[model samples]
Structure formats: structure tokens, C-alpha cells
Target: MNVILPTVITAGLFDSLNPCAISVALLFIALLFTLKKDRPFILKIGFFYIISVYLIYYLIGLGLLKAFSLFGATHFITKIAAIVTIIFGLLNIKEYYFPHAPIKLRMTHDARFKISEWAYKASIPATVVMGILVGIFEFPCSGSVYFAIVSLLASKVTYLTGALYLLLYNIMFVLPLVLIFVFATNRVVTEKMINWQERQGRKMHLILAGLMISLGTIMLLLYF
Candidate 1:
């Protein structure tokens, strides 16, 4: 239990630093600013969007957990997840070094376009839909930590307990978005954040690469 708690928290925090989700979130903030939406309106839209992300991600976690339990192959799946996480880490490292590589872990062009289209609307419902899109599309780039954490939970805990940990993990996952939304209410702050993210984007991938590789190695050693 002690090990699980720290693992979940660390994974969630690291995953929250994902460039895919952060870039989209910054874009959403920038769009709302461009539309001349007031702070309250922006906050309202951001609130719903963040909620949509949280709900979608939590539900997805639930589904994964249930699937693992149903299959009664938690050990097998955990081993596979560990290996996949290592592969994902290597891919992230590749992204940092060779961003233009033919294979990339990122949202597709079409997904980005769709998200942008909806984000331009700047309506509460539209933002919610866009959030859902972000949640779904950002998975390929940002889901490795989540997949590993979920697999660990399946192997180590019961369904109900794992569900509670999922709640904690996801709350941690969205904490940065919440902070970003709140601070980005200021245009200058928003611009600076955007700049910061651009500068540190590749570094974020590198960090994730290291963390994922370490976690995967640890999981393999301890469980497999």
C-alpha cells in the first residue's frame, strides 16, 4: 500500500507534465483570450473543459481496470505493460532527439484540427467537447504512465480500492491544468506560459522518458 500510493502519485504528477495535453490547454487559453472572453466566462468554460477531461480519463481508467480484472491476467498484463512502458520511454527519448522522425507520439493532424475548430467556438459546450477530444487524442502521447499505474493497481489491489486510487491519480493528473487555467486568466501570464512550454517541450519528453524507463525497470524487477 505504501509503495502503491507513492507510485500512483508520482506517475500522475509526471503524466500531468505531458506536452500533448499542456499544449492543447495553452492553445485553449490563448483562443479564449483572442475571442475577448472575460475572465469569468473563460473560467467557466475552462472549468467544464477540465471536468470533461477528468471524467473521460477516469472512466477510461475504470474500463481498463475492469477489463484487467475480468481477464484474470493481471500478472501477465503487468509484465506486458512494463515492457510497453519501456518502449514508450525509448520513443519519447527519440522524440526529444529526432522530433521530425517519421514515427511520432503525438496527436494526429486531424485531431488537432478538430480540437482547434471546437476551441475557436469558445462556448461552454464546445469547450467541453474539445476537452473530450483532447482527453481521447492526447492518450497516445501521454498514457504510458497511466497504463503502467493501472496495471500495477490491477495486480496489487482490489477493484474498489483501485478505483479510489484512480480517483487520486486522476486528481493529481489534472492539478496542473487547474493551476494553469487559473493563472492563465491573465494575458501576460498566459503568454509567458506559452513561451515557457515551447522552450521546455522537448525537455518534458526527456523527463518523461527517464521516469518511464526507471518505472518500467523497477516494475520488471519487482514483479516479473
Candidate 2:
């Protein structure tokens, strides 16, 4: 309980710092500002978008947990997840150093373009779709932490308990977005946030690299 709880919380927080999701969220806010939407409307759109991301991510976790349990491959999955997490960490480091790396963990160009189109729509349904798209597309960049956590849950807890932990983890996961939406309601703050994200993006990858490498190494040492 002690170790697992901390792991879930830390992993969720780390994953929330991912560039993919944050970038899209900031873009959505900027778009809303350009549309001259009222504060209430903007808040409504943001709420639905965040909720969509939360639900989609939660469902994805449930699916992975069920698959691991059904296959009786918790051990195998954990080993693979650890290895993949380390590889992703190294990739993040590579991204930090060589920003033009041929292989990168990020949303595809097409996904970004599609998301932008939806963001421009500035409608509730469009924002919901954009959020779902972000939740799915951002997985490539941010999923290593989630995979590791899910693998741990499958190995250490029953289905119901794992579901509960997943719920908690996902709440933490979308927390940053929630905070950003709450605070960055104005154009000035939103623009500053976008600039900050662009400036600190590489550093975020570096931080993620360190955390992922450390977590993966620990998992390997303890389980493998």
C-alpha cells in the first residue's frame, strides 16, 4: 500500500506535465480568446474538454488493466513496461538534446493539425472531440508512466482496487490542465503560458527523462 500509493500519485503528477496535453490545452485557451468568447462560455468549453480527457484516459487504463489481468501476463507485461519506460526515457533525453531526432515521442503532425482545426471551431462538441483526440494522441508522449503504473496495479492489486487507484491517478493526471484552465482565463496569462510552455518544453522532456529512467530502473531492480 505504501509503495503503490506513492508510485501512483507520483506517476500521475509526472504524466500531467507532458508537453503534448499541455500544448493542446494552451492552444485551446488561446483560440477561445481569439473568438472573443465570454468567460462563462470559455469556462464551459474548458470544463467539457477536461472531462472528455479524464474519461477517455480512465477508460484506457481500465482496458489495459483488464487485458493484463485476462492474459495472466502481469509479470510479462511489467517486465516489458519497465524496458519500454527506460527506452522512452532515453528517447526523451534524445529529444532534449537533438530536437530534430528522427524518432520522437510526441503527437504526430496530422494529429496536431486536426486538433488545431477543432480548436478553431471553438464549440462545445468540437472541444470535446479535441480533448478526446488529445487524450489519445498524447499517449505516445506520456504513456510510459501510465503503462508502468498500470502494470504495477495489475500485479499487486485486484481489479476493483486497481480501478480505484486508477481513478485517483487520473484525477491527478488532469489536475494541471484543470489548474491551467482555472487560472489562465485571460489573454495576457494565456499568452504568457504559451510562451512559457514553448521556452520550457525541452526542459520538461529532460525532467521526464530523469523521472522515467529512475522509475524504470527501480521497477527493474525490484521486480525483474
For lDDT, the strongest prediction is 1
TM-score, each model? Answer: 0.98, 0.98
Task: Please give, for residues 30-143, the per-residue lDDT of candidate 1 as tens digits.
Answer: 888888988998889989999999999999999999999998989989989999999999999999999999989999999999999999888888888998989999999969
Against the true structure, candidate 2 reaches a TM-score of 0.98
C-alpha lDDT (0 to 100) for residue 209 of candidate 1: 95
What candidate 1 gets wrong by more than 4 Å, as runs, is none
**Clash count, predicted structure 1:** 0
Model 1 per-residue lDDT at 180: 92
